[model samples]
Target chain A: MIMDDYKFLFKVVLVGNAGVGKTCLVRRFTQGLFPPGQGATIGVDFMIKTVDVGSEKVKLQIWDTAGQERFRSITQSYYRSAHALILVYDISCQPTFDCLPDWLREIEEYASSKVLRVLVGNKIDREDREIPTVVGEEFAERHNMYFLETSAKESDNVERLFMQIAEDLMKQARSRDLPRYDSNTTTIDGKTSTISDFSCCSK
Target chain B: MHFEIMDYELPTNFDVVVVGTGIIESIISAAASRIGKTVLHVDSNNFYGGLSSSFNLESFLKLNIEKRKSICMEHSSLNDTETFFPINNSDFTLDEVTHQWNITNKNKNYSDEENSAQEDIIAKEICAKKWLKDDLLKESRKFNIDLTPKVQYARGDFIELLISSNIARYSEYRSITRVLTWFNNTLEVVPCSRSDIFANNKISIIEKRILMKFFTSLDDNEDLIIKDYASKTYKCFLTDKKLSKNLIHYILYAISNSTDSTLCLEGIGNTKKFLKSLGRFGKTPFLYSMFGSGDLPQEFCRLSAVFGSVFALDQPIHGLILEENSFKSILIGKQKIKAKNFVLGLNLTPDFFLNKVKKKFISRGVFITNKSIMDSDNEPLTLLLYPAENDKNPCTVLELPWLSSCCPKDTYLVHISCNQINNPEDDLKHCVKNLFTLNEDFKAFKPLIFYSSYFSIPTNSDENVNLHDFNNLFICPGPDSELDFVTAVSKAKELFLKMYPDDEFLPRAPDPEEIKWDGDEEPSDIAQ
Candidate 1:
């Protein structure tokens, strides 16, 4: 809970086809504050959540986007700077489940290299889940994505998702600090961005 | 092998038969079984995985590791100083192999030189041009798509509209899908106005107006520019303004490239339909898969199995058997099973199904792997690699963190789809060979072959061809031209009605007689 430790900012973008709950999930996570009822997210909304992962105190900047087909040109820009992405699909809906690859592809394009993405099947609480859990895990596993089934309404695994992202980022930072690779890192775009400056621990 | 689960002799005849052993077929059979009816599931191939399955685990894992390493490079570069982003050691470290597990010293020099050449070629051929006015005009006529040429400091253009406009109010995933739809011609993009939206003070006045003017005129009509600049293909358009090459490439990569732009407008359309069909969402509008894409489907199967849904393997339905007013049972390996109801989750022809549907619709290309290629203690999850063609190739590639279920260490799988638009046999061969030459990481791993095929739905109907008129039959052909998505899903629904009773509702599926299979001559009334 220390303010200094909370300085570490990790931006996470939620992306998928239209009506995949990209917005609802974000609002559920950010505004719901871990377990509550909320409506759809408008256009683009950013929320800050402070979470303690073991000893590391991480501040998560969550960007909830609109999944409509007409808005790709407008919302695509936000994808570039994200440190991680949560690709969500409705389990009750097969097409949404089918479209997960495309959503993951966007994360690959716009997000930073260090982006840690988790494939999430939202709405697992429903009785007639159209998409089976096995298929979903296979999709994520095939693409090397960390996979999980979660219900934003149930607030199931909501906390675990963020904690995992924070852990991933911390591990990435440490790995970059390893001996063989140079201390100074330059981005693929040639800009000299530094993650070490924003480095903060959970404690 | 466990013999405790004895095989009950399956029925010899079925009312309807479905082909393909992929996820879609599994769902169809499971759904049929859940409704208290007997169903037969079959695959033409000896094994499963028609675009969705991981037959060869080694390549899958290798691809993932390479993807992770690429992401690691991106992470390190994003954090590094100018010029150096530590390339080695992260997430899963290289014990003896590079991030891609390229252990052979012979390939290292070739890989390095090849990568550099590819980069240069990509930059020169793909990145040499700025967005011209005419370049923004052309798009897929069928899909109603369009794009704006990227010009440097061209403020107020599509990019500005994207950043400034508050589109989230319209829908949960409006902006991203909107942009992608526009590019893919799946949805019509009503260019949101960008004039007042770009009035940021941080940007200088000139830059601001450039951005502003560009944004405001995006919706205006323009000419198409298909030109070759520095040997790279340039599809530019005019919007009453001009921009730089760098800006244009960024826009294209962000919207059209492979990695980030995998799903286009068509995908959005199907997804939108699915969400709407679910009715309303309350406090719990959104749901996520517990274990990944594979887990959710598996859960559905688990639930369906509990409900007595049977999934038959090694059974591929080649053709349907009709008997008078009702459809007879399907033939699977000289065995026939009879059912009170039947639902087909297959294409009209197996080969056509494989070429058009399996290769084009269901499959995706990716780099996957297991066990970190990087030498490190606590492995990083994702990696971004620069493919030789990253600059010029419209498709973007990345290595994601390894998934244990798909590939346990030292094992991996990657899916390669032949261009359905090409000649079938040639396309498949080229697809396999090109996969190896396309990326350096794939070169190290030997590809153990696997096969799966799917077909597209039919269009243009003929008389006397009712696939669902029979008492004991129904078919759910994935996505097709003749029938709508609602009709396809409800084909199963109507079949379910045979078992459950509510006031008999209208048939939701397209009339079977209306379905038109390609290459088949129209059945005349006399024939009927």
Candidate 2:
């Protein structure tokens, strides 16, 4: 899809279990500044970073949800109507990595079905890997999601992850025949790929 | 010279010293100065009035007016007669324009309840009545100082009115008479309605368009401004189409074009409330402050000067050498001195004298600018959530235009405040990006404007005092130096009056204090 078709800014949410280094990943990618010491994200922190993935000044309103369970309800609310979703898991923390299925089901139900989903296995920085990168990628492939391994602390493959998502979303946004799906309940399936039905912009 | 008060006699040596010649240290050095004070006053910076000093500021203001007039000439059609331009291109900062658009429609949707609050302008007459009965008046009278009605007189002194009104009440929510409209068959406050003007001619065509924009300003869409949407409420009387256009401009011009809804609402509500209080009172002056509010402190200083109140400059007190009974202090480049009484008129931030006493004081940087970064003839008052980049020393900036009648044309003042907080550059940048517009005007005219940058000193927060004195302190450090500057000069004047009841007080500008430490002790935290 041509990137010039979209105009208005959009806010996308990234949700996953704790120890995922979601904050570090975002900081490395958006600011290009390494975190001195990464800490667990406390509450909701959002960053509006302009990316050149589609050769346009597209501002991505990236909202990072806290991983703590008590914050689940708060994070759940942001899932509604999000243009895209990045459900991440820590490869080192098997418990967090295991929660991917629940996370996917939740996004499928709460977020738009057509929402562009990307599965990220974070914390690939350590040498002694807990969850194999192949397993994570296989899991993503099975679920029809584009998967990639990232290390926010070490600054590895972080840019490519967001750029790929942004590129994919721009393609969908550029399609004219695509029917505008409700914000929640949309998925990344190719069947609804017809670009004709999509209207110009709501504003 | 040094004065050391030791065992009723003076000591010849000192540990720390503070310098600079301004009223900010008046109370701080008064008692110390009284007893063979070794206090040093220096004016190398060539400024004596501290922050309130009108000496250099006056000519500085005139230069601003000249600059603005030139811009007016550049933008005018060449047919105008008045050399004094109302407002022009150079008069605004780039940040103000971008800020204006963003604030007016940050969200893109409109809310009726919030808009109605904007509509009730509270006419001048109505405001006087409210002021007469305000509880703050009693405190003012008890203090026995006459607070000349500042409302309706000079547009600048209105800040005092708002400050006082907030003290008396009206800061909390209150219901007011408003018109409602049907949207999707549900009753909503009519977005464009005003109570000040006659109902029939309340709005004009341009005002209607502006009102529509104001209504839609709250849309969450990325294209709109959120701060301006929240900053103003435009109420319209829809019976006539002609008035809508005029009313919209009127509201747009009147409000600082702030997109922050909370800030917009608070500003408008406080303004109307101030006027309402004035209307309640019978006294209303069209042009208040025969001299200016800054004149008030200057006059007090002048009176003190008539007495034996010797003033100095450039000599900043590095630190106060306080030990047991007497506080001996050293002045910059001078020997230590002792005083009988010591009152500090300097900003009371932790670093003020904390390190002198403790020996390890850290300096926090705060930035300030007066350029019109936000849209408004009088720039919208703005606060930065944070700065843009952090590798740069993280500092916070507080921007407010000094529009007092005493101030010159389109003179936007910028202030950056920081304390102990590091890597706040991103926060500061965010604040500038979101709240202010970095327009071409700012870029072209920035060099022409002198940038007076200073670090903020913390002072005691006068929260318990009546609203008039709420934030009042001899010197309170905030994110910048002006806060301390304002506090120190004002507080010095008060303390001076107490000591010398019949002296003429001459106002002065703020001065920086040099903090002293022995080997490497941290500065004490006096700013709490």
Candidate 3:
């Protein structure tokens, strides 16, 4: 039962252009292995993993969305409810790197204002590195995002990226857990609305 | 990743090309894709659930403001509008789209001798109802207002469709918490179930007895209740029952939901439908999606995408080519994608095809307030049916509190809709005044009018046209303003059958666990 005591559950969505190795990155973090030439994600797939941050355990519900242009509508709708967004780009593919602004535009439109954003450059193991680490860091800085570069094939910084997200979310979960006057009868969530006042809504 | 789409080898061939992402078209896309049909579902708008999607506060206001392509920066630069925003059937022209806002300034110097009104945002409008613009925009993420207002009967065709297709698994369902009717010049909760009737103190025992007897009679001897009244109005049949005024009001306006001139048999049929639907899911017969009715279409879209349907947003079909007897290709931008069959929603349809059909419209109004008309332990999702008043059509008012996920925290979004008469505001004004405090009054229990707007959308469902003009293209009508989605689902099923004469329609999709995967040598994230 020690495993079931995770205090907070956060939904983390991974989105970027295709061929950026999003599935490889997720597999490397969740299962400690990466499949070479991972196929395109069909719709979306999700997995939950618990990590201990300080004294409390946090569960990360990671959603990997299909990066193909045609599936944008399906993936974009999943953006609003996400707590963190990991925008990935490929270091070897200039086109995928060039599409960072497009990915940023989608995030700005669909995700919430307070969502934590991280910029990731995947496939750093490739010999032809079209985008430099300095450029990736600068792009992250310009957009006020946290930046990290990883290679799913080498398992370079893959676990570190997911751990950083969990730690950041744990910090968020703790701050919001602070007990104030508790005058907040109103909620932004649908859960509180359901169980609160049966008299008002129910016959 | 399905990454690296080659423009040279783009998907040019499909079995069906659905041109709109609305409820009807999305369902057809899912149905077609499920039965081994290659479907290319596209919308000119950049969002899913075209005309049926939930909207944030800022975009919702911009859509109603008309011709103002962009929100002026002087007001607020919160919404970055660089991406082109195209308003569709949900967008309406505004002759008098006006608003007044008052936000009390908290950081002002206080002097006991000086008397002054609190610092406000704006104070020019004469309307008694006003909203704080800053208050609404602050929590915009909590709101999910739908362009079309609707509910689903527990055993309704749409519910059946959702259940059978397994699209219901994609969404959370909430019972329509309550039903109210405007009776005796006041809003009252209509008791549909047996327990509700007995527990309500407003209804006398004798009245309840008579109501029960009538409902029982309808079930026990429907042949007698509906007999000899085929020619006359339902109101006449009720008058002949010698029931008290209270009992008559409950049966006619609340139970049957009939007009004064509704034929007796039709009224009886409607009442029977209502009774059978009650107690099926919850106490109420109706069910509403957790977010808005907009979620229903997206659920189908999710199902379609999982089944390998290619969806593209902001890709409008300019026109289609007809060769001999069938549609050959759809002209999107400068590219022509060939398809054997086509499905289209009846919005912004091309003039070449427009000359062959007629259209109608439904007036709609959306408002956000701080409280419900009737208070209870928690906020409720309610459907209130206001009887037709003189010189106005009857209106349906749906209220979704924060729990309904249709409004921001501490707010309820009320949607009023009716058949378009003269204009939107004119047709729905009386019902709005009956349940809401249009004028500020300290003693009134009616919810304060924090925000309100009215518009009409064109629907060509009433049009009678020969399909021979474009046999391969099936046009799904824009949603008519109504309480439930019975007609919408049935129409989708009928249209689906016309094109897919022999194929099954929307069979249940298997859950992920149910699908047998080959031996897992490598754990791909999609399979993880």
- Give the candidate number with the greatest TM-score: 3
What residue pairs clash in candidate 3, if any at all?
Answer: A40-B1, A40-B2, A41-B1, A197-B377, A197-B378, A199-B376, A200-B376, A201-B380
DockQ per candidate: 0.03, 0.01, 0.17
- TM-scores of the models, in the order given: 0.34, 0.27, 0.80
Per-residue lDDT of model 3, residues B133-176, tens digit only: 67678777667777787787766678778777766655566777
For candidate 2, what is the DockQ-based docking class? Answer: incorrect
Off by over 4 Å in 1: A1-203, B1-5, B11-18, B30-38, B44-48, B56-248, B256-300, B315-319, B345-398, B403-528
The window of 10 residues in a row where model 2 chain B has the poorest summed lDDT is B141-150
Every model: iRMSD: 25.3, 26.5, 8.2
Q: Rank order by TM-score, top first?
A: 3, 1, 2
Best by lDDT: 3
Candidate 2 local Cα displacement, residue B507, angstroms: 32
True-vs-predicted CA distance for residue B403, candidate 1, Å: 4.8
Total clashing pairs for each candidate: 150, 206, 8
Candidate that beats the other on lDDT, 2 or 3, i.e. the better one: 3
- Give per-residue CA lDDT, model 2, range B369-444, as digits (tens): 2244323332333332132133332233333333222223334334344333332233244333443333322223
Between prediction 1 and prediction 2, the one with superior TM-score is 1
- Name the lDDT of candidate 1: 0.37
True contacts kept of each: 0.00, 0.00, 0.10
